[model samples]
Target: METEGVFQSLPALPLFLLMFSIIYLIAYFIVFRNWSPSIRPEASSCLISLSHGTPAVFLATRAILAGQNRGFAASNTVFQNLVLDYSIAYFLMDLLHYLMFFPSDLIFIGHHSATLFVFLTCRYVVSHGAFAILFLLILAELTSACQNAWTLANARKGDVEFAAKLYDFLSPPFYALYSIVRGFAGPYFVYEMLVFFMTGVADHVIPRWVWISWIGVVLMAISVSILWVSNLWLELYRERTKKLEKKMR
Candidate 1:
């Protein structure tokens, strides 16, 4: 109880920074230090996937356990300190990692920056609708985790026949999951958030500016996801074209 109270009292950004540092250190030790140097990047991503994905799925489960009457809302204590804390921390780390390793990736940097801004606002300024947004954020990560796993495992040296076979097996499901979550469900969640604000349907009092800020952030998230999904589809299309040519030959 005391610990929970302390967590509740702590400011959101500081808490996020603290949690991110911890997760970064752990990921460094697990991925960079211990993994194959060739696959370090993928391993680092894998660590992040497990760290964030596990908890998001767990929180979703807890909500399931709590039963269906619980409509999507801003999290309660356990959800906030446990789930949201870790989430913001992961985003912070992800943002920094991209800045350091792939500085040219401006799109990702912008996505992370915009997301961090909304999270910080929820922590400090907004009083309502955060849980719904956070839930969506984490839910998206669930598919990301699986997608990363598939990518990392596929990035192996192998015979051409075996590699092509593996790629064919894995690519469809991965794209399907990505499409369903980031493409389809993502827009739905954004719509829900919009409705929450437009209809004055939040769980707490949301100031006008806060509402505007939150809606903008959600829109940004949706925009990025659309771009990402488009890229995935393009890759899938090219892969199919290559296979058709090989068959014709």
Candidate 2:
């Protein structure tokens, strides 16, 4: 089938959203219902994050490897479809979840909005940088499984020993992965886009709105990374100091 024809017939974006919405509903009503009210939504959200994130990591990795010789423009369109599908679903669910359950979480709302805007732009408007977007998706999703697992552990704070041990074991790797991906690579991706826009290296010049949305997405990622990492370090410091003070007694 012609690629464009397939895209038209498949309607990948809406199907993706519908599939994940069903999954999220199942998770919320069936899987996570036994959990405490406050924890259920977050736990369900974590599961949804992993569900999309795992495949994204796989598809993005494959695309990047396969595209090395051919370049992103020649990369498999399937990979692009998968990445955009997973992202659109995840972001939509996240936005809806936040709106319904945690409207005050403005940071996440901003993050989701900016990300969705850019993804939709790439899907419907400019389509030159699919490979870069997929690569960045991989970098972003690699930490989701770990981060959500760690978060779920912390939420069940009654398991103090388990939480502490898991935190200690997971903290280093999570921080490192998050830093490498969002902290460093995210900014690099933004820089490359800016250069492309400014230097006219791309086949077609990206629109100003696309550039603005893309920058907003990257900045949100970097800002969240800084805030989260700083808070993590601060918590670790407090925990260490408490232990130190107790030891002095």
Candidate 3:
């Protein structure tokens, strides 16, 4: 009864989007008031991911499990739709941040744009595939907390000893987790999604091009993640080697 009431009174998607945007502003203007001007906006952006990632995983899981009909193109339940709205809101806010502060970062901005297109289509256009997309969201965000921590640590490591140490401590673990997810798990799931979508089982539920685009966007994102993490691994190896050389000298 309580849960039902909660769903009944859940705010509309636009209002939810507004709330997420407010959270981003609050992070930059209030919580990180003392942070460096350049770093603060990015930090606040990371905060929004932290605010979204883990919780979205759990919520997506709950929605997936509670849903009655299940398929790549099955109709979405109320809970599932709500979870999609939450993710859509997060991506939109984060996209705005990148556009405003880091417009030169085409990789992130493009990635966010592609992701939003996929999510928007799933939520509004086709009204299906919440299961697949939300599961992908879970995989994508599984390492977000560690990644964000490492990012924050990396951002300040130049000037702060503790931040440097934290960055060092976090690098290997975060890289391994991200690699496993992006390299192995992510590809596997996407492969499943592609095969499922290709079968035309969802022809009546989702248009062909839409699911194709979703798969394309997902594949591109995974490729980018692999490339991004590969660079981090190389950088980590060099950093550690330099540390060892300095200590030995």
> Considering every candidate listed, which one attains the maximal TM-score?
3
Candidate 3 lDDT tens digits, 18-86: 987888889989998898998999899989999999999899989889887767778877688888889
> On a 0 to 1 TM-score scale, where does candidate 1 land against the true structure?
0.76
Pairs that collide in candidate 2 are none
| Tens digit of per-residue lDDT, candidate 2, span 1-249 | 375576657767778888888888998999978888988998888888888888788967775675544333332355565567668888998799999999999988988888787777666677656666777787778888899888887877575688768867887778778778877877887777667656544444356666666767777778888789879878877987999999999
TM-score of each: 0.76, 0.87, 0.94
Residue 194 displacement in candidate 2 (angstroms): 2.5
Clashing pairs in 3: none
Write the candidate numbers in order of decreasing lDDT.
3, 2, 1
Backbone clash tally for model 2? 0
Model 3 Cα displacement at 85 (Å)?
Answer: 0.4
lDDT digits (tens) for residues 1-249 of candidate 1: 686676567675566566666766676675467556656655575667576776767765564444333444443444454455566777888887788777897987888888777766665555334456556765577676667656655664243456456666777787787777777787887787677667666535566677677678777777777787688779889978998999999
Model 3 deviation from the true structure expressed as Cα RMSD, one decimal place: 1.7
Q: How accurate is candidate 2 locally (lDDT)?
A: 0.75
**112 in model 1: Cα distance from truth in Å?**
1.0
Instruction: List the candidate numbers ranked by TM-score, top first.
Output: 3, 2, 1
Q: Lowest summed lDDT over 10 consecutive residues: which window, candidate 2?
A: 67-76
